[model samples]
Target: MLEEEYQPRRELPPHLRKAPAPEAPFSYELRDAVLADMPAVREIYNYYVANSTVTFDEDRKSLREWKSKFTYLQKLGMPFIVAEAPSGQLLGYALVSPWKQKRAYRFTVENSIYLGPAATGKGLGRVLLGELIDRSKAAGLKEMIAVIADQGAESSVALHEKFGFTEVGRMGRVGYKFERWLGTVMLQRSLK
Candidate 1:
């Protein structure tokens, strides 16, 4: 568990670009995910699936299937965790998985984080990600990658950068969503 600490960044996304102050983050819990958390975890991810191309998951998973997904991550020894409010409401979830299926790519993992729609902009992403990076390092992972969906996906890309992730690649117009073509940005952070 991490105690409250704040470090404001100079660059912020357009929506939050000119805000005069940072919001106080709520007290939250971060812990490894159990099978029972799939429902709430899926609920958090479902919003992005329906509204944005942040995730390419066109079809959402049922609890049974989601459990399988979690099981697979466990088999790979990847970390899957959630952030929750003091009242036990899930605020967000994050995990690291194989960056690629090949054996040579084993040392690198792709990271994903989804804050509850109402929970965005609270600086909790940094808190969860800070811990995520720590855990990955402890697990002996060498690198972590983030394949963010679009140039406009600045908040997430910036979050990664804040945690020492650097932009490694960009492929334009790689995905079609909401009747528009979107670009993909790849960012990397070393765990060593």
Candidate 2:
């Protein structure tokens, strides 16, 4: 949970404010997330929660809370993967979790992807998501959905489009963050 004085979603500290300048291609590997990667995972997620409307949650979660969520995903056998640079930096992560808990919804999943603030615009998202799609299919998932919280996230939307996801729905003014009414766009693709 965030303190009462937490920064508004629209206003972030300099480091978390914008995508860093793009860097030359670097060595990176896509692999299954380990129990030790939760801190890096939390760091990336908390940035979005605290600094942008990419996520609707306004409060940063504690490490314990995140580990609990991590464990739950593991229990469900959902995919959780991380992007690690050769230098040992955890650049980003992508995962799939249940879209809903109903028995009838077991074959569907919601996707979440996040990159380190400095790691944006470097094309890691494409790599992570491609691998995620392969793994999801291998796990026998029938559909994958992305609930994008910001309509202005062009890159994310474009990435999904490039991978065959189509805009299935939008809920305008459905979320209030940073003292403004925000919207959510949902995109989906079939795994089969």
- Which structure among the candidates has the greatest lDDT? 2
lDDT to native, each model: 0.87, 0.91
* lDDT tens digits by residue: candidate 2, 83-157: 998899999999999999999999999999999998888889998899999999999999999988765687899
- Candidate 1: lDDT of 158? 81
How many clashes does the backbone of model 2 have? 0
The weakest ten consecutive residues by lDDT in model 1 span 1-10
State in Å the error of residue 85, model 2: 1.2
Candidate 1, residue 15: how far the Cα is off, in Å: 33
User: What's the C-alpha lDDT at position 8 in model 1?
Assistant: 59
Q: What does each candidate score in C-alpha RMSD?
A: 12.7, 12.1
